[model samples]
Target: MTTNTILFDLDGTLLEMQTEPFVKSYLVEVGRHIGDKYDTEKLLKLIWDATKAMIVNQDADKTNEQVFIEYFTANSEWEREEVWPLFDSFYRDVFPTLSHLTYPSPWAKKIVETAKAQGYRVAVATNPVFPREAIFHRLAWIGMSADDFELVTVYEESHFTKPNPGYFAEICQKLGVQPTECIMIGNHMQEDMVASTLGMKTYLVTNWMEDRGEPQYPVDQRGSLEELYQALTERTGVFAQA
Candidate 1:
């Protein structure tokens, strides 16, 4: 059987991120650059608020950028342009340095190449929470590149984020494939595994899985990327071609 697409999540799925350390380092670095202008706790709260708004935002009238900007302006009068440098300086410098908190999973890179060699369309369906540049840097840390994926969800380009069926729908429509023709592999049970509702096959990368209360959907569990590789071929019958 030919599986036309495989959608992978970044962050904890492809890249191993120790949540506390990464966030701590991130807040520290960004705080160092912009803290004096804004209260550190309040700034963090604003970011969380914007993220929550993004999760519940289903309005057809607004993009994520618009939602975030609207929420940002309402919460703090900071100019949008002023915040741009934080992303530029932080992701390029401080973020990369935080790589010490993460490591390349050779298994993850190998799986992508193996799937592509087997004629499956590969995509990084990472939540569109971060900018493309940030995603690109994370991919680089794992010895992958933006060019490795047929589709990569970036905030500016995507209207919907994960856990929302619309996010998966957008990728299907863009790739010209039905949801059933794609498989979503990620570590978040709530966010990534929810793709099954749209009929996409689901796999749990449990290396860094989060306990999301309880699962509302069924998924195949694989402990590591290496196991995922074998499981995908076995379950999809991709190996039968051999």
Candidate 2:
């Protein structure tokens, strides 16, 4: 099937960064900021538990953010109004500091532009475990913005997370396209490429590769951002003008 929509994973694929270190830094900074009121270890554990709940969530009534918030506050002594603002503040202030761990890819802007110019709808299919504020900040680090994509999945807007074929299906539903009409470009083997299970074409980006195990999905293409740019240009005959 011909591809009309392209879903790009944000962290390691479009924005250059090592996922492990970035995540560690994020957890540490968040823990330190909220340490005075909450036990650092316990708080971190709660965050993970809440995140896992969001991942496996199959509920259509509640969004991933709602699921996380309910799970997080219900299991803790804190109230949502009190704790959520603090988390938002950390994302606004402390999260930007983590940008030093990431750099903008030279081909990032070109790739998105080329896809759009070639008549493909673009969306950021980053894991929806993060709030919109955090996702927006990360996009800024790469010199992009939420305005760059047709749709951007955030915790508040998504019901499922990556590695779940349902997540891709939900996105396709939102985009009003068939799964076969969408192409997923991401770095992780398990998380991103699993979109293939739903018939969406997959591209395994190797710039900051995350290998989980032997490949279980078919990748229609694989390469660095620069290589992807060239491939897209050749295939779509859409190039950025000087």
Candidate 3:
């Protein structure tokens, strides 16, 4: 089937960064933002727990934000009205400073432009564990924005998270396309390549490839973002506009 849509993962794929250090930096900054109001360890634990709840959430009625907030507020002493704004402030004011830990791929823009030029829809299928503001800020690090994609998944907007076939299905449904008509591009074999289980073509971008032995699904292609740019340009027969 002709591919009509391309889904790209944000972290480690187009935006280069070591996951562990980046996450630690993020948590530390958030801890600094919270200060003595909450214990850093306890707060981080709650965040992780809420994130896990969002990932496994099967409730189609509730968005991921609702799921996360419901779980987070319930487990913590803070009420939603008082604590939610603090989290938003952290993303808006503090998250941008972490850009030093991530470098953009030279071919990132070209890849998206190529897909658009070839009449394919583009979506950023980043794991929806972050608020839209945080996701947008990360995109800005690469000189891209939410407007660049047909769909950008965020916790507030998504009901399912990555590595879950339902997440891909939700995107396909939103795009009015079949799973086979889409391609998933990312650095993780288990997370991105798992889209193949639903018939989506999978490309493993090895820029920061995770060392997951023996992928559960077939990888249609594998390469660095630059090579991906070249391959996609060739496949789409669409050169970057001068």
Residue 168, model 3: lDDT of: 90
Q: Evaluate all candidate structures by whole-model CA lDDT and list the values in order.
A: 0.78, 0.87, 0.86
- lDDT string, candidate 3, 1-242, tens digits: 67788899999987887777899889888888999987878988999899899989998888999999899988998777877788888887899889998877667888888779877789999999899999999999888999999999998888898788989999998889999888899998888899999998888888788856765678888888888888777773212222
Candidates 1 and 3 compared by TM-score, better number: 3
Lowest summed lDDT across 10 adjacent residues in model 3 is found at 233-242
Q: Which model scores highest in lDDT?
A: 2
Assess candidate 3 and give its lDDT: 0.86
Ranked candidates (TM-score, high to low): 2, 3, 1
Which residue pairs clash within candidate 3?
A: none
Off by over 4 Å in 1: 232-242
Q: How many residue pairs clash (N, CA or C atoms closer than 3 angstroms) in each of the candidate models, in the order given?
A: 0, 0, 0
Alpha-carbon shift of residue 56 in model 1 (angstroms): 1.4
Worst 10 residues of 2 by lDDT: 233-242
Check candidate 1 and list the clashing pairs: none
Q: Residue 99 in model 2: shift from native, Å?
A: 0.3
